[model samples]
Target: MSDVFERYERQYCELSSNLSRKCTAAAALNGEQKKQMISIVKTGIDEAESLIRKMDLEARSLQPNVKAVLLAKLREYKSDLNNVKTEVKRLSSGGNYLSARDDLLESGMADTLTASNDQKARLMMSTERLNHTGDRIKESRKTMLETEELGVSILQDLHQQRQSLLHAHNTLHGVDDNIGRSKRILTSMSRRMNRNKWIIGFIIAILIIAIALILYFKLK
Candidate 1:
């Protein structure tokens, strides 16, 4: 269950990154170039929706309202994307108008020139903001991946240590068994030595008795 959650979280993060990258690229592009990124952005958004639903199912306590809000926001983003696409198409089809407007703006005598410059500045600022946001998200993702890798390394090391301790425990048990066997052998040997000493003493006593008997007989 934890593994499933982890996988879902990873997928959500990856989709978020893909969406951010696509948005950043879209911000800097216009016309066909920007249009080309829309499908990729939509794919990321769809994947994110699926991931969130999976997460919500896993966490029963999760509020459905929150998911609804997220889906609503994604819909808004999609709407905005369509509007931008339409605007790009319109601008691309009006190339002659754009060139004429640029010439007039260069002449520096039209009131529309200032508004155009302002709009361009705003677009540039928006692009920069998107790029900055994408960079931060990318950095955060990289850090997360690194932390996960470190955690895995630590777990592997701990497992190896545990195995080593188990092996050492088994070895100690074997050594203890050998020591017990040696002790039993030593005890048996000690008992045999004691019996041999008693038998030798009895034989010596018998020899002395025999010598005494011989002396008495000779005297008789």
Candidate 2:
């Protein structure tokens, strides 16, 4: 990163020095020389602008304090470059100063820079979209994991309930068996009590009859 900044700074310094020299000499030159000077100025300004852009990009990756210093430096470079461009325009202000070719070249350089900036903008937008998509996918994955855990918990509860129901059913079956056994025992006891009662009544009536016959004999 520092290397990139150094390269841009170096280029910016060279372009600035070269433009100032050419602009200083531009007033004394003849028509062709002045045109050449203007041409050099145009090219230097373009290169300087390019370097400033590179430096600006490098600044973006820097620490905030360092980035601020670099940005301030870049702004100064831009201002100087703009001044050079204005000087060139002043020198070439007359009618029919620049040829159609120079105009075409300048326009082409501008178009290229604009296209590059647009491409970078598009790339940034695409990266942001990809980030959003990744975030959503992560959230969806988390939701799916939570849902899976919930499902497992529900299944576990169902299994526990089923076990409890099976245990209850077994207990009820045992209780039913005990109740049936108790009913049978009670029925047997009732039958035995009824038989004993009948036997006792028969024995009592026989005693009474025997006693009456003895009384009649005594009377006779």
Candidate 3:
């Protein structure tokens, strides 16, 4: 258990340390900075997934609800990171100058100042959202760690609950399969019985007609 905890801790530390470096590098305006940010976000996601996997393995009984919440948070971070990348690309493409043209006009710069102001506002908003996303990621990580700690206390309860749920699910699945099979069998049996009934009626009608014909010929 200590080994598992140590591994998780080491991965978390490595991820956090790298994140700090990436953030510093991203403060600069260069292609390298953008690349670093992308790499960092990817690494963060990988580390989070690794942590979750480790928790699952060690716990032997992780709460599905908790896992679901953590996964949702991770997805939110991924979306936010993608949005940040998009904003960076737009600014780098000179779209910012086009967007703040109104602000530029007030400064006798025709459209440039207005466009710059609008772009700045957008950039500020994007930055805020990015920061918020970072905070959320941090909170999620903390929650995950806390859950791991609590797992020791709740292992027996969680194990029993998980087993009960699994058994219920399996039983329901089996019942559904049996019901389907029974329906098919009944349908096939009905068809066969109906066909045989028709065949028997036809044979009886033919035999009666033959007897009538013989009686008519004998009377003649």
Pick the lDDT winner.
2
TM-score: the better of candidates 2 and 3: 2
Tens-digit lDDT track for model 1 on 1-220? 3456567767776666666666766667655566567656656665675665555444432246654654564455445445544543343334433444454445553568786776566556655665687589669968975875576567657766887999999999999999999999999999999999999999999999999999999999
Candidate that would win on TM-score: 1
Tens digit per residue, CA lDDT, model 3, 94-117? 333333333334545347777677
Off by over 4 Å in 1: 1-119
RMSD after Cα superposition, model 3? 17.6
TM-score of each: 0.47, 0.43, 0.36
- N/CA/C clash count, model 2: 0
lDDT of 3 at 148: 67
Query: Order of all candidates by TM-score, from best down to worst?
Result: 1, 2, 3
lDDT of every model, 2 decimals = 0.63, 0.74, 0.62
Q: What is the Cα-based TM-score of model 3?
A: 0.36
Poorest lDDT segment (10 consecutive residues) of candidate 1:
88-97
